[model samples]
Target: MQDKLSKFEKAALLLLMLLAGIFGGLIRYFHLKYGFDALGLAVRGNRHAVILAALFALITLAFAVVIVLALTGRLFPKDAVAVGTIGAPTILLSALSALAAAVGTIVTLASAVKQLSVWGMLNGILFFAAAILTVPVVRKLSVRSDSASPIGTASLIIVFWSCFRLIEVYRTVSSTPSVSVYFYDLAALISLILMFFGCAGYLYGRSGAMRVYLTVAAYLFFGTVSLVGKGGLCLSALFSGAPVAMANVTDVCVYLYGFLFALAVIPTFFAPRRADPVAELIQAAAEPEESGKEEPPVL
Candidate 1:
């Protein structure tokens, strides 16, 4: 394979990717707090907010198109990255995110822990059960251990996106549909699709690992930004003595899933240091009938 990108092009691309991440994180923060349509009629309609929404919509749609095209076998991203195994930094981040999330959960529930209802119990059970099932994701990244099954990961991804983001999008569209809300609807739907692909790709760990990494990063970035954006709206409403558009439990779960995606990134980037397992995965991915031959790593 040839490295076609000039140094400047590569640098520019990295910067753009980083910016996208920052913006997405902001949106996630807000979205989690203010709930669906929090950014729709009130925010997206504002002239200043237009720039924010426009940038996010552009990023979401752009990545969505690329991933969809690639999935359909029509095109693939040009930039090449070879991730051979999961790394310590990724595991550390994952651990930190999970621990922080746990502490946050306990604190929030402390006030009402004794009055927990069936809904709360079910939600907690479902959330923790899903988290437990994904434990092997990062743990096995270093050794190419098949402890985490793709099907399990897929189920979790689909369930979360469907139950949370997709339903929220639906509720947004159910109301009066402005141009901005329509745009929001489309962006939300596309992002859910991207999230699904990104999560599924993490377990594949063969070729296109860099693509998986970028997709997962983009998904988490969007998730983070949405949560932050909603939080911004909710806090303002709280101070002004207005009803806050908050879904505390659900929003936290969504944020934790974003963190999970961040952890899954470990396997997407760092491959096993040994080539044997890498070769086996690649062979199975690329050609099962052909003789097992090692292909040079992508640089």
Candidate 2:
């Protein structure tokens, strides 16, 4: 049954990647000549969209291949569990996280340059550090022997980052509260909080971490809704003769983020419970010892 399920999952993943590739090709073909003006600069609209789609499709295909190989026990031979539990998903998530952080750093740096604000400079530096640190952290986590430590550290970092981002979103909303934006921010904030607690529980050897998969699923769902829904709204406005410019870069990032989250959730759902050495030791210690008395003839 497990083998059958694994086969099914691999087939589904391959199909998904194939579809992504086809969709990307179609979009590129249809929008080949599209162009637009942005900030007094002429931009190749179709080119950007085509590149984004192609890149997304390529990455998806690569990830699918990696997953298939891992599932087949061809990758990370000495650490199959780690590959399934953390390594594969970490590749996608960490790459996306780093990309997002890099974008944020660039934007913050630009803002600081324009405003000459010390705080903006500091914020930009922090973003840069996050972008640079993500790779090493993810690498360490991927190869770590114990899963709990890496997960706990990652979750804690996510919680803090999410809190900061949420605060920024709230401040923006307070000035001009849009329901859509607020909903997106709220979903993310809740997801991060749940993940934080879940990881914390797991680190402490509690079983409740298993339940956090639901929250992570919710997070991925809402994030998809927010990004795709916004894209849909942009299309609607465009068709309605509004001159709104959509950022393909952001769209690509969001797509990768959603895809990685979905994939990450899958392994988490199916991963076997790892044995806790401490818990086993305690159990053994608690067991009553057998008496060493000499046998009384009958024995």
Candidate 3:
């Protein structure tokens, strides 16, 4: 069982690394196609800001890789590090991603309000709150022995948000959606479906396969959507000679959320199973009591 679990962890880690590479490649391709500077100035229009953000993202990814390696015993001996130590990076990453999302939502909401788009403002606010709340839940999951509840809850929230965003984009593009935008929508829809099943499996504490499936699906779709959207924006900006919109910045932040969430949930998939208290309680209640023994007082 331990060996099988270790294999799964390694596989998941490899998939994540591959996805990360693909995402980075797409970003670079867009920059090159758009004739952006090394700092993505043409795309973001703020060299210093883009540079800083890019640096931060790189650091975060590196940290994530290190944590996963340590957890897998690739960076150290099998017993050298505690699981909690491996989990620390996940907590930090979650907090940082949540912070980024919150900031992006605020910036986006302000702009939307200025334009008097009620729906936009509402969506931004809703997503903002959801993103912020995810931090504490993820933090709790990291240190706690039993993570099913938090995992299920987070999965549901993310699925809802993804579906909401998908619908909003679909409505906006109903008239004449571009191929690239349609790809983005498809990615969001895929993520929603995967997360739904993932959440269900976690809540039920069954279907380990479903959990792994969701992890891969989430990571793949997350990378794909971000790449499609950002790549499209870069291409458009290139042709139009316009700077990247603040919306693109927001998208970057949103992309980080997916990456962080994937990292946060991976360990849970490999964790050893424990007895469910509720199940134990139900069994105890159902069992027949000894005829001669006095019944214990109910708590």
- Models, CA RMSD each: 8.5, 11.3, 11.4
Ranking by lDDT: 3, 1, 2
TM-score of each: 0.58, 0.49, 0.57
Candidate 1 residue lDDT tens string, 1-299 = 23334233333443465567556546544443333354444543444355556777787678677557645545433434444555666666666655544543453344235556444444444445444434454454344333456653544544463354455545546675345433443443355456545445545544344555555556554554544454455466667776322434344444555545455554444344436767788878878555467787999
Output the better candidate (1/2) by lDDT.
1
Q: Judging by TM-score against the true structure, name the best candidate.
A: 1
The residue-by-residue lDDT of candidate 2 on 1-299, one tens digit each, is 65556546544643554454344434432332232233323244446454644555565456556646664666433232321245466556667767766776676667667779676576567556556655554443323244466544554554455455456546656654224224443554555455445544544445233234334443444444344444545455567776422332333343334344344444544444445578899878766443345457974
- State, as a TM-score between 0 and 1, how close model 1 is to the true structure: 0.58
Tell me how far the alpha carbon of residue 228 in candidate 2 is from the true structure, in angstroms, after superposition: 1.9
Report residue 194 deviation for candidate 2 (angstroms): 3.4
Q: Which runs of model 2 end up more than 4 angstroms from their true locations? A: 1-84, 87-89, 117-155, 177-181, 204-207, 231-262, 273-299
Spell out the clash pairs found in candidate 2. Answer: none
The digit string of per-residue lDDT tens for model 3 on 1-299 reads 66566556555654765465455445544443453455433444644334434743673467456656664557543532112222555567777767766866876687688889887787787678767666665544323333466555664665676666667767865664223324444454555446544544545454443344334444543454454546566566657766435335555556556555655655544454445578899878767554447878999
> Each candidate: how many clashes?
29, 0, 0
Cα lDDT, model 2, residue 5: 62
Candidate 1 lDDT score relative to the true structure: 0.50
- In Å, residue 50's CA in model 1 sits off its true spot by 1.9
Which stretches of candidate 1 lie above 4 Å from their native place? 1-15, 24-45, 68-82, 100-117, 141-197, 200-211, 231-253, 256-260, 263-274, 277-299
- Which sequence of candidate numbers ranks them by TM-score, best first? 1, 3, 2
